[model samples]
Target: MNAQAPHRQRKSWIIWSLVTMGLALFVGANAHLAYVAFASQPDCVSHSKGSGEAHDYRAAKSAC
Candidate 1:
């Protein structure tokens, strides 16, 4: 079987290389998800109107 040893080794190397690549992709995706979960901020707008005791305030997409 010595004649086929090199071919078998090459196939094993290719499989391991693909497994490593898949692991790296999974890690990168999780890192991106964590970053977005922690680092994202809301973009919002607000408005306020007042006339003495008739004061009013409001914010878009949220309660003010």
Candidate 2:
């Protein structure tokens, strides 16, 4: 019984360590994605003309 205590404690420590590492990785990846989204600027391309047709859709506002 006493010998099992150390083994169980070691296993619990390993599980908690893995969980912490996984959370850190998740947060780091999201932070990197957010940084890229904010840091990069993409040029806008022209779209098809609306021509006031029902099928055609126009942007509410143009960025270019």
Candidate 3:
């Protein structure tokens, strides 16, 4: 077959790299956001809102 054009080859490589990097960045950002949201979330409550926090350590969480 005839040789492919240089411009076409470079364009394909550029498009492929951009798509992969875009996916990587999107996933990385979402993971980071999830980590921060959960890790920094307010403690779970089991008091007035969580069984009225009867000083029950057995409570799944504490509040009030």
TM for every model, in the order presented, reads 0.64, 0.81, 0.57
Clashes of each: 0, 0, 5
lDDT of 3 by residue, 1-64 (tens): 5467887899999999999999999999999999998889575654444444566345444453
Ranking of candidates on TM-score, top first: 2, 1, 3
Write down the lDDT of every candidate, Cα atoms only: 0.80, 0.90, 0.77
TM-score of 1: 0.64
Model 2: CA > 4 A from native:
none
lDDT (tens digit, per residue) of candidate 1 on 1-64? 5899999999999999999999999999999999999898766545554444555654434643
Error of 2 at 61 (Å): 1.1
Q: What tens digits encode model 2's per-residue C-alpha lDDT throughout 7-34?
A: 9999999999999999999999999999
**What TM value does model 2 have?**
0.81
* Regions more than 4 Å wrong, model 1: 44-64
Model 1 lDDT, residue 60, Cα: 38
Predicted structure with the largest TM-score when compared to the true one? 2
**Candidate 3 error regions (>4 Å):** 1-4, 43-62
Top lDDT prediction, candidate number: 2
Question: Between the candidate structures 1 and 3, which one is better when assessed by lDDT?
Answer: 1
lDDT for model 3 comes to 0.77
